[model samples]
Target: MSQTIDNRQFRLARRPKGLPERDDFDLVTEPLAEAKDGEVRVAIDYISLDPAMRGWMNAGKSYIKPVGIGEVMRAGAAGTVIDSKHPDFAAGDKVSGNLGVQTHAVFPGDELRKVDTSLADLPVYLGALGMPGMTAYFGTLDVGQLAEGDVVLVSAASGAVGALVGQIAKKKGASRVVGIAGGPEKCRYVVDELGFDGVIDYKNEEINDAVRRECPDGIDLYFDNVGGEILDAALANLRLHARVAICGAISQYNVTGNVGDTGYAPRNYLSLLINRARMEGFIVFDFADRYPEAAREMAAWLSAGELKHREDIVEGFDTFPDTLLKLFTGENFGKLVLAVER
Candidate 1:
């Protein structure tokens, strides 16, 4: 028998000012249509709420188009297939794709990847074994060009991607791994739990001073997640021929004004020239072709107990708007996933 399910979604009520508010999203329920040829309908289990979503909301030039007014907010999601018309996928198959923020999504079968459930949990596909993990893998290896015995420093050390960056650097034979995170608890987790060589509590200490103390020899590779002042500080402590991977900049996402002047600027531009360092920004989507390769490696590490992942799962689909705010505030402990289904 054919069944109809209620599809609840969070729409952009309006563009945000500073931090996005509840009013910015309008919760609406609709009826989903049946799948056509080459399509698959997903009952989304977990929706990934990332800092990158903030940039997607703004009407500006970016890697992808901004979420238009009254459109469903863009996001990455993992779920199970209830219906399929595509040749590659079948009913009851588990898949992960960018399904936006909704209880159900009908997308082209070619857009989705069938996941192996036995290897890891479903939410891990949205996190450690997913986009965040891939971001850390490619950003550090290709962009940062990390070499053996190089000193690697990561900012936003306890978040999804940052946590993986530190761990991967360690596995690749980094001589020293330093992490900068907000609050004492996260700092402790990065060092004690994640096996980072040192940690800097950014909330309590001056970032520049902390970097100087933790990295006496300067940083060979800097995996920047939280930019702004910390980015500037990292620039001041770059070693000769240092590589800086600009993965994210959550610190300046909510700001309404100009970033170049109002925000913290690196006073060490001269040092970049003198040290012959290179700074490059990359989006994970740029390495989409190599996702399978990266996923294989990350999964092997997870299975071997060499890689660790954490998830901060918030219950209920209705809490999507509120839960997303947690990432900006650092309220989430790990990869933040919104559980839409019971």
Candidate 2:
């Protein structure tokens, strides 16, 4: 008898009102389909959980089209190709891409990139070696236009990308690197473990006051991850011609009310004018052609102990909804990923 395989997926059942709820997603299982010509069957090992996933759930236009109701929730994942009919792929090859929230998927081989397990663990590829790494790399160096001896400040300091931004800033010869993260524990980790020059416990300290003290010399570059009050604080401390990389605005992700009504818009626009600063937003996909070059340099940093990486991996495909909720709550530390195979 031939073997029978099952495919499980977390599909968007409805648009989320705020933080995604259980009913927003539907878990469904079906028999795995065979790989057809020009297609490959991937046995997903892990799924990435990112703050931007929230934006993808909204009803309207954005950088990427919103996940329509009933579609498999969009995600970047890593897995092994179990069956292949395309020239570029073969069975047993490990690959990563927008694999969605599923345990098994049959896709055009062109949609995947082969990953070497010897280079990094599969989950790490979904974190430091994946989109997060690419985001940090270009956002800091290219978008922010960093300079040696510059004072750098990055929000969401202990997170997957933010953690790397601070470290990369320091490596690139920033005179001071200050990280703004929630709570004392994350702050300590940012400074002590990640080698940030200083850290602000944003949950406890007055954000504006913290930024003022931490960047008394003025912020030369600000790699912002959590916009809102944090961006306001960073704005107030900018030096002349300072550059700000708008990496993400996770602080506003779960707002159930009108996104405009949140009243979190920067009140310090005058600072930008006064300081002649520049602020630019970027998407990692914009730099996809150069990912291999960035990955090589980052891999060298990782191997040399100059760059630090972290992840918060949770098991169980059935727990997808609850696990995704953890990103908004900050319940999962580091780069959040799902161990889909379990």
Candidate 3:
């Protein structure tokens, strides 16, 4: 007999300006059918909430197509397979993929990866061992071209990707790992807990002043998460032959009106020419073939206690809209996950 399940989903109700409100999404329940050929039906357990999701909502050009107005809000999710017609997957297997925001997903088996439950928790797959982890790894190593003893600085240092970037730099023998975050608590976490060399609270101190004080010798590698003013500040303090990995620009995601020309323009563009530095932006999906290698190394680090992860799990699927706002507002700590089922 075929099984039918009621799936709850959040759809994009409207485009948002600044911080997204509850009205941006509509939650509705629908009946889900059995999986088709080469597909598996998954009961989604954990859904990842990322800062990048904000960019996906806007009607603009990007690495991927914007979510259509009536479409399900795009997301990364981890869950257990309930049914499968794919030869590679089976019932009860744990899988992770871009399943969007829903209680149930019919995922293409080719797109899903089987996860080892012994390595870490399910939320870890959506966070430290998933897209955020891979982003931190490739962006720092390939884009930033990090080397031993290089001084590394990261903005949004308390978020999922930034936290891992700092830790990975430390593991690679970085001389100084400095972080810039929003408040005292986050700053403290980056330094005291995450083993960063220093931290600056952007809320209290000016961005350039903060960078100047912490990175006196100039920054060799800047893993930029929050661009805008922070990027301009880091540009002014680049060391010779420095590399900047433009991972994201969270600061400018919330403007309601026209994205004005008044945004922070780096006054230190000459620094790149003077120091022979390189700046590059990257998407994690570009390194798809290399994910296994990254996952192996990151998993090893996690098992060896060299890598640490933190998750901010929000309960209730119905609160998806409200919960997503936490990332932009700095209310979420570590990797944010929403638990849809028990």
Candidate 4:
């Protein structure tokens, strides 16, 4: 900890178009700064790769600010506190926070939270034990107002948040849980492994008909992650008083246009009115303070083998840009993560 270690950082080099490419980010190395008073220096272990990061790369106002050109691309990461100058943190404490896309980070101690590796692996802290998990919890249980025996349908049902939403609904007593994934493999995993009632292979199947077939009666809750055609298809099957938790729009995140353009909007407004269903969007940060409460329940589920989490981790910080593309193409099988090496 005494000797200075080099920090490699990936900064936003320019605004991206359609989908991000390698040139959109610039990688550079610099000497790690010393931890000043009330600050801690962490040796980052893993970087979270999420579909929402694509939206943060654009040039517009969003739920979160865009990653400014030349700034380290904002990301959620976890690592060990190698050096600390604050009363609340110790040198050996593992922590999680907005550590960015870097090999090391130095920030105010208040910005990081201690991580207990005994509870889960560090990368799990970036996945099931992280924002994705919290989003699924509040979005399904609270926002979706999921009730016992409700029939639920969720888009991107095999991805990070969607996977949990489907399983949680079933555990909470949903009579049927149908998932819409991109392929046969993901569809099988969602159904056979996650205990969903059925799955629609959106990449190769007719979505509207499949949803109707899966939830013959009608869908009572729709947890949408892909917002384009899939959303419209899900809307077509909503039952009376159905609720749609708008967790994300990964399908539209990379859709860009001239500055100030509002981007892709779903064309199924009539369905919401006809069925008297509610569609609401949420940010996981809004429930930050309640994370511990949610994590405790999730841990119990994990301990009792009721919850399953999978991470598709790629190594090396150099693969940042290319690795991000895996999300849009649906190549990443689970919560994508980058294992950083120092």
Candidate 5:
């Protein structure tokens, strides 16, 4: 006789029209089944909460398919393998992948990647060493084409990706790096804690005026995480031939209405033409083949104490709905991660 295990999951109940509410999800418990051949079973420990998750819940065409109603909500998670019927993985191995929002998950072994937990904690893989880290790496270096002595500006500077973007710019020899964040505490953390050259408190300062004052030499590179007014401000102060990397637009993720109607589309886009600059959007998945290259370098930086990372972990799997709202409310100070209460 084998021991029985139960799986707890949050299934999508509706396509949210605005910010997602608890009612949009159906929390259900079901008995876990044994893994089939070529499959592995994992007990999820940490789940990533990103603004992109909001976009993934909507009904539409996107870089990835939307989570169908009644399906387990899509998520990136890290966990330890508890059972494996595959040759590549075994019990006790740590792994990370699109494990969905569940206490337990079973997937084809090929869909999961084993992570070196000796180098980083399981939750760190969901932050600085995970998707956010990769996004910052390629978005800044490849798409933004960061160059030495360039003055860089990044919005949502205290966020998971934006924080790394600013630090990477500085470490790569940017002359100066300025950040824009919502509150004084976040602004201070961006500059005092993260070593940004300067920071603008978007809550207190006029975004346009602050951007002009901070990047007096004009911005050579703008790493945009939160779009809308911040992006427009960055555009208005671009240096000659500057590059703008459109990463994730957290500011616009939850807006309702037609594509162009609800969110604030840039009013200063003409600045791109005037400055002879380039603005391009990139998905980190596009650089999937080169992830090892980025991971190795980031790991080295972390070990060398040259890179700083933070994770705002919330305990309890049942708190998923309210916990996710923290990202939109600017309450999460760093990378938002949900840790399953053991």
Candidate 6:
């Protein structure tokens, strides 16, 4: 705290119509603030780039409030504490929170969760040990209500949330776990690396046909990350009493106008009625009180090598606008993380 630091941040300049452009944000450098009583100042190390970020840029009623124009862009970030005025946190402690798109930030100590670097890397906290992990955990087990011997299908299978959903399903005794991902490389990773029973390369194959082929007996649980046609494809193959966990709709996140007007809605939804399936959408924060429970199990899986996670690390805080597009473009192989340059 002795030396003055300039904190650079991306503030929302305007609401983006479709995909966010660099102009949508104004990068400003300002003097960093000192931590007040019970507050901590952190030097950000990594920022999470997620599909949900696109939705947050819009102005409307949603799970979370939209980032106001002129406000720092909202983002989940992990960092090392530069200074702390809280009893529990000390300087050099690693932490993660909704720290926004900035090089440094200050927040109440209760708002930041201290992380252990010994168990995992700092970036890993923004991936498997963070919101994405919590989304996959509760989305599969709680919302999807996965059952043993069920045939599970996961859309965006190689993503931060989808990848973990497939693996968690398999570990919980699912008879088969199938993933839907774009491109051959992602398909291979979902199967060869993540241990999914099979994967459909959405880029090469028709999603509906591929879903039917991979899940011939129909899917008992579908954990959907990329909605639209992929969601329709999963819906068409639902088994009796199937459960669908709608974790995200990345395919529709960039719609220019009203989502229902411009986005792709399912055409095969009738299958849900025929199969008596349940489709539910969930926000990870809904299960916030139980985060420690999920973290313990996820950590155990990581320690035992039962779960595998990958982080697509992009260097430089300036790359955030372009980096986030990777999620919609299917360029990121795993969890997309932005490493803030010193």
Per-candidate TM-scores read: 0.97, 0.96, 0.96, 0.96, 0.97, 0.98
lDDT of 3: 0.90
- Which lDDT tens digits does candidate 6 get at residues 1-342? 379989999999999988889999999999998889999999999999888888888888788888999999999999999999998899999999999999999899999999989999999899899999999999999998888899999988999999999999988889999998888889899999999999999999987788889999999999988878889888888889999888888888887633434478888888889999888988999999999999999999998888899999999889888988888799998999999998
Error of model 5, residue 97, in angstroms: 0.6
Cα lDDT tens digits, model 4, 240-295, are 88999988887877766222243666687678899998999888999888999999
Better of 1 and 4 by lDDT: 1
Which digits, one per residue and each the tens of the lDDT, describe model 2 over residues 43-88? 9999999988888888875788888899999999999988898999
Candidate 6 displacement at residue 78 in angstroms: 0.4
Q: Could you tell me which 10 consecutive residues in candidate 6 have the lowest summed lDDT?
A: 254-263
State the lDDT of candidate 1 residue by residue for 34-102, as single tens digits: 999999999999999999998888876778888999999999999999999999999899999999999
| Cα-lDDT of candidate 5 | 0.91
- How close to the true structure is residue 191 of candidate 3, measured as C-alpha lDDT? 90
Please list the residue runs of candidate 2 whose C-alpha ends up more than 4 Å from where it truly belongs after superposition.
257-262
Model 5 error, position 251 (Å): 1.3
Q: Give the CA lDDT, 0 to 100, for residue 186 in model 3.
A: 94
Every candidate's lDDT: 0.91, 0.89, 0.90, 0.88, 0.91, 0.91
Query: By summed lDDT, which 10 consecutive residues of candidate 4 come out lowest?
Result: 256-265
Q: Tally clashing residue pairs in candidate 5.
A: 0
Write down the RMSD of all candidates, one decimal each.
1.5, 1.5, 1.6, 1.6, 1.3, 1.1
lDDT per residue as tens, model 3, 47-124: 999988988888766788888998999999999999999999999999999999999998899999899888898899
The TM-score of candidate 5 is: 0.97
